[model samples]
Target: MADSTSQPPRKLAPPRFIPPALSETAYPALKTGSGFVSRNVTVRAWGGDEKLSDTQRVQASGLAGCISGTTGGLMRGPRNILPGAFVFTLGGILGQLGLNKYLRHQAQQPAPGPQEPLTERILSSKWSPFSRLSDEKYIEIMEEKILRAEADIALIDDRISDLRLKIQERDQRASTDINK
Candidate 1:
């Protein structure tokens, strides 16, 4: 049997519904579509697509450079901003071109052979003072340097001897003149 103190269950209210009216939805859809179109147009104008040729890639890089320079100049405030932008734009183009050239050069170089011994690898590394120079080559280079130094020293000695002879001749003439 139910307890006499029990109360009846209460019913909850249903959720409110908002209708999708064209006036409310159309503006946002149009805004989003326009933004999408604008982005695509800007990217196309900048040659930013992946299928671009080398010339196109360079042009895109130049555009990127120009944008970067303009932003940098703006960040620095009003003084000489135009000049700064021009300088940075030029720098960016030249720097990117140089980087591309270096990368192409590196790509064209032959790949290294199979794994080398640890000692050989370490010795041949760019950080090593003896990079690419074998013991025989190092010795040959040192010998050449030594020969050059010796020749220079010989020339210096000859000059000193000639100066000494001139001094002796001058002193003898001075003494004879004094004795006269």
Candidate 2:
């Protein structure tokens, strides 16, 4: 048998002599938006730079609202133009403001505690259905299951034995016929 305690073989080192042009072309050093120097280039976020003032963000949100409102107004007949634009624009602004507030609040709040293991959580929770059962009751249920499984296995074994006997009889009959 092979020795399980033996150390694994070391990985081979890459060749030192990479062409300068190939190296520069393949792995050019690029600065990320977060100001980290990395070998791979990253795509910029939508609307170019990350530094947007509150006014700019609000304006962009308002512009989006206007576009959505105009689209909605167009969808509803020309008769409902004024009403659609007014309602949709107001709704969009309110929705955007609510979303921004929610995001800010979420950001301000402390992160949640480390999660409990599923089994531990289930056993500990008072609301869990299984939590109502005592350890002794659980053990009793498991024991009943084991007994049922053993009974099933016994039945399967008996059936297998019967099948083996039938197979043996079939072989014997076939052999006798061949001899004749």
Error of 1 at 87 (Å): 1.4
Question: Per-residue lDDT of 1-180 in model 2, one digit per residue for the tens?
Answer: 779998889998544334556655432221111112110111123343355544454445555455555544444446555665566557656765777788789989999999988998988888887665779999999999999999999999999999999999999999999999
TM-score per candidate: 0.37, 0.43
Which candidate wins on TM-score?
A: 2
Report the error of model 2 at residue 161, Å.
30
TM-score of structure candidate 1: 0.37
lDDT of each: 0.66, 0.59
Candidate 1 residue lDDT tens string, 2-109: 999998898975332223455366534443444345435545876556666555555555555555555444444455457655775576567667877887899899
Show pairs that collide, candidate 2.
none
TM-score for candidate 2: 0.43
